[model samples]
Target: MPARADFPYYDGRPVPITGRGWILLMLSVAGAFAALITIPAETFPATLVPASLFAGIPLLALAHLTKRHWTALFGPVGLKQVGQMFLFGILAIIASLAAGVTVYLLGSVAPNPAVAGMGAMSGTAFVLRLIPTIPQLLGEEILSILPFLAFLWLATTHLRLGRTTGIGVAIVSSSLLFAAAHLPTYDWHWVQSFGVIGTARVVLTLAYIWTRNLWVSTGAHVINDWSEFSFTFAASHVPIGTR
Candidate 1:
């Protein structure tokens, strides 16, 4: 087992990354695809699912490398911090809902303006789409966060950098990687997705700045994800042509 002493400790307590040092990374990502495969094979689009699957790999690698599966991915969080994170997440959701609603309303004025295109799908199909979204928020957050946190761990452990510097580097690196992961398909939707992701990254960074604990930041991330998922799901359900 790796020593907790060797792990980064922003609050003077070491973070652990043992059982999931490597394998958890693979499984979380694979689990995402496994969820995707649940969609009737033919119903799954080749374009989007592949990106989701690809996006999951980094988190998997982070989990495996750190040897801590969930914490590395989710940020070594605790219950109190979870509550705080939930609060921030609620704010994020409100912001996203406001933005989505604004977009919809703004579209009403333009000729053939765009919006989230869920109305095109049948009810059953829309429900099926929800399956991937659920796992995606949960799974991808795990994958997205772990490696960056792991990198923070490595910097603190090996480089003996200050907590702030270590965390700052981790946030920037993670966000950049998150953005880069979307490089292959730099379309409007992808840009929009990365923008949401980047904003979440900034929020997580704020949590780290305030608490200096991996747990708080991780919780913030999960909350952001939950917020995005809940809002996007609801937004998708709204009549596309209505707004």
Candidate 2:
């Protein structure tokens, strides 16, 4: 595995992003959340607008900061990478299952309102909602991977930590951030957020750490969530008390 902050845009760049750049990137993410609330998402299709901004703004800031090298962050998306996407996506789901079990044993697992909301949705409505997930999941992956890389840079460069140590710290820190982002989604359930969601993040992040490609990790994320959504939709249509 590449070490010493081999993250795209953070490495081999014309000008490396500085602390100020990190602040701007985070601010762009904050602005995205602002846009999400300011805009109406009552309709399923209307969600595309906010989801697009959520994915676009931080990505645009990253490209601008790195001299318009957006491709570097996306990396290659060939057959091999697609295979990795499915592979890591399965792994993430399994990890979340185990984490959910453990958390349930400890206390309770919070239900996801989004998945529950799909129970009433028609096939057409489900597809419409699925459309928004493309950008929404991309935005979710960007939010996680960017911070993972940033913390890796901080640990290796400033903290003078070893490569493995830096990666571990980065994964934990970024996972916490990912979990925190989902606080509202899980109805502010800290246990579920930090336990189940955070655990899934650890594996999804590894997809990126291994490939240095955001697309791979993002694809894995999409697979994981899409599978859940599909399951929810299918179950909703299944006749109750029937095999």
Estimate TM-scores for all models: 0.52, 0.93
After superposition, which runs of candidate 2 have C-alpha atoms over 4 Å from their true positions? 1-5, 11-14
Tens-digit per-residue lDDT, 23-132, candidate 1 = 45535555654544454443445435644664555545654454453242234456777787777666666654554455556443221111144535556665565554
Global lDDT for candidate 1? Answer: 0.52
Say which candidate scores most in TM-score.
2
User: In model 2, where is the ten-residue run with the lowest total lDDT?
Assistant: 3-12
Q: What is the alpha-carbon RMSD of candidate 1 to the true structure?
A: 7.8
Alpha-carbon deviation at 32 in model 2, angstroms: 1.9
| Model 1 lDDT, residue 57, Cα | 56
